[model samples]
Target: MGLFDNAVPGGNITKPLMIALGALLVGKMLSGKSAEQPQEAPAPAPTPAGTTSADGGLLGGLGGLLDKLRDAGHGNVADSWVGTGQNQSINPGDLGSALGPAVIREIAQRTGMNEQELLQQLSTALPGIVDKLTPNGQVPQQHQVASAFNS
Candidate 1:
């Protein structure tokens, strides 16, 4: 119904996780683009290299994450978040499995969070973040995503 329908439950820990994830995804989107391809959307100022990592094979940005979710049999859940519908909740364990070990490990390392806690926070935050990012029930252009992130 509302954005963040699955609101993150904890304080302090949650903000950094969202920031880390958002920064990583945005960095991937920017860096993955090439000189040959026409820039589809304007980009925000480049992020610091230290904040971005090629950790999860998230080379394709949110789409790559969606692909991983679909491959892990969470297509419906991913779709629900992308579509104009109620966001589907994911179990933390299921979320971990969908993201796989490399991603989880990388995220944990970056966030200074334990695997279990990272998964728990991500499971709650991701759907809402995806929902917010895809406000029109579709993946937005890169500039649009950057704007959303900026806001």
Candidate 2:
């Protein structure tokens, strides 16, 4: 459960649900292993400077994830999650395509979910979770996001 275990939000996401997302996009990317098994994995690849937050931790990784979604032709969907207005929905199939097969397979392995179930859960929960994380229509600072997670 790594960093996110101590950082579950009390908003649109539940602890049980979001741990996988956190691990999938943040922990796994940064640490090269599931949050549940940090010690078992090799050292993580280094992130280039400025690719993330000041500390280059979870919030930064989350931002990068949003960028990935945007780059994959889902900017509107990702933007809606961070905007002040209504949240937009994404289809599970579309989400899977955006994430690509390698990521899907990796996350599926880490979370012990099939690709379809994983995409379904993420599509259902991601909008509200992103909306909650971006309460001011902006990505929070690393410290702010960390605090939110811990609260």
Candidate 3:
């Protein structure tokens, strides 16, 4: 399947929603690189927990994040973020519980927004972005997300 398979019909670009996805991926890549590099000097600030540096790790971690949502009794909402369909609304309160403090805080830092504002943005954007990522109605692999970035 093509990248952005779940984008809005009529070929609308999903770029705006990519913010959360991009932040998650960047968290993974940056953390992974630091892990690989044996830094002798004072270590850089770590990426938040629940993030990894591997290319696919970000998507996988996001899938896990969705799972957390489901496990938190929001399966229907989580499912809405997966396929190319009308994305259901997500409650920021619920999303916050699923994302955890560290991850949320880190994302806020990465996006240069305050936590409350970041949460609001994420609640609005994540479903569409994740739907775009999982064009095949399933979680995409690392390379797929990478190719999407390049494309």
Candidate 4:
């Protein structure tokens, strides 16, 4: 008998034929789809005005600020500024409103600098301090006031 005829026991081709057919069927199933067809997935809804993509409104701004605070190792400032007890909570929105007066008082208490001198020095150093905080030369004027106090 030839080598090809004796390759399988009893010269049966049925098993080999079935195996080839099964492989072909599997190949057809896997490769039959066209690449041009678009996949369907659920679309995300639009965000409302004054809202962040992930969360809503002012809370998003506070979340971003908290990240910056952690990076700066000054997270205690947020807790100290907002936590209960002798240190009254100040709204993030009102931080600018309270900054100038607070800076003057803090300077007076810590450095024994008079209010007028503190104000004068702060006013002089304010613009450079602001430039350092911002990417470009511009910082929002409201943010500049608070940043000056922080510096």
Candidate 5:
């Protein structure tokens, strides 16, 4: 009988042995080709120029100065309403008004939120917005004064 025919039908012996022999043949062929292939060497890292490294101290000092300036500005606004006894709600627009249009626009752009929505969130988060803008913790009367003078 032939090599495969000697094995019983539906037996595990012939099938597994054939598969393993085929796999070994393929492995041998691939390994022979891989051994003749040339391997590429890794490139060396680039060296940084200049004698002194970049100074982060200057940037840190500038950042600190900016923080101090921001704190001072907020403090000034808070101080403006220290004696005010009014309970008026501060809106988003009020905060924007206190900070100016440029700052309000910048904040809106950076946060990816609408100006009105940002204003509303700030109004809820920081009730101090109204107090800082007005003596009575309400919308400031400056708008009316400006309108009157303009008209």
Candidate 6:
């Protein structure tokens, strides 16, 4: 095991799972508002940020974020979250490096949580959260990813 290697055995997570977990936590910041409830003003559906596949279509950003992590050499940890069997735990420090500064800053700004706090919360939630998302022991498709957030 090295810097970007999966810290736990049989652990698996993926881009979609991590991004969804982060987004889910951010959404949870809305003071007791359950994401499952219908809202007074329904949120806008996700749209592509640009003409790219990894831009912004609801979960598009998340998908892109996952790509970044994989590119950063944390794919194994991410995949473990999506893979079958036991999910792995992540080090908050490693997460910062895997996601890089820009993305971390963006998430921090959006969630209104400091970098360390956000990472800490994300680390705790990500493992179990992603496990739930990939119940079939496989990463979900783009549409399935988006639908989970919408509902």
Best-matching candidate per lDDT: 1
lDDT value for candidate 3?
0.60
Clashing pairs in 1: none
Clashes of each: 0, 1, 2, 0, 1, 10
lDDT of 3 at 140: 68
> Mind giving the per-residue lDDT tens digits that candidate 4 earns over 3-104?
224223344333222222111111121112212212311232232233344221111233333333344455454443233322223332233222334423
Error of 4 at 41 (Å): 61
- Could you give the C-alpha RMSD of every candidate to the true structure, in order shown? 9.2, 5.8, 6.0, 32.2, 32.7, 9.0
Over the stretch 1-151, how does candidate 1's per-residue lDDT look in tens digits? 2333344443233444654455345554333332232432334433223233342223346776787789899999999989998899999999888877766765565555788988887887777788877877888765665555445
Off by over 4 Å in 2: 1-16, 28-60
Candidate 6 residues 1-151, lDDT tens each? Answer: 1211343233443333333353433332222332433332334323323312222432344455456557778878777777886676789888777666655665554444678887876676666655655667766665665455445
lDDT per residue for candidate 2 within 1-151, as digits (tens), equals 3333322233344433555565433453324424565443545434333344323342245686687789889999999989988788999998887766766665565556678888888888778766777878888765555455445
**What does candidate 2 score on TM?**
0.67
- lDDT leaderboard ranking: 1, 2, 3, 6, 5, 4
Error of 5 at 44 (Å): 33
List ranges where model 5 is wrong by over 4 Å.
1-88, 128-151
Error of 1 at 48 (Å): 18
- Model 6 Cα shift for residue 74 (angstroms): 2.3
Worst 10-residue lDDT window for candidate 5 reads 50-59
Off by over 4 Å in 3: 1-19, 25-60
User: Compared with the true structure, what per-residue lDDT tens digits does model 5 show for residues 1-151?
Assistant: 1332322223223222221121111112122222322341122112122111112111112222123224535444344333365333444555555545544453344334577776665544333322333334333343332222122
TM-score of each: 0.69, 0.67, 0.67, 0.26, 0.29, 0.59
Model 1, TM vs. native: 0.69
Regions of candidate 4 where Cα sits further than 4 Å from its true position: 1-102, 137-151
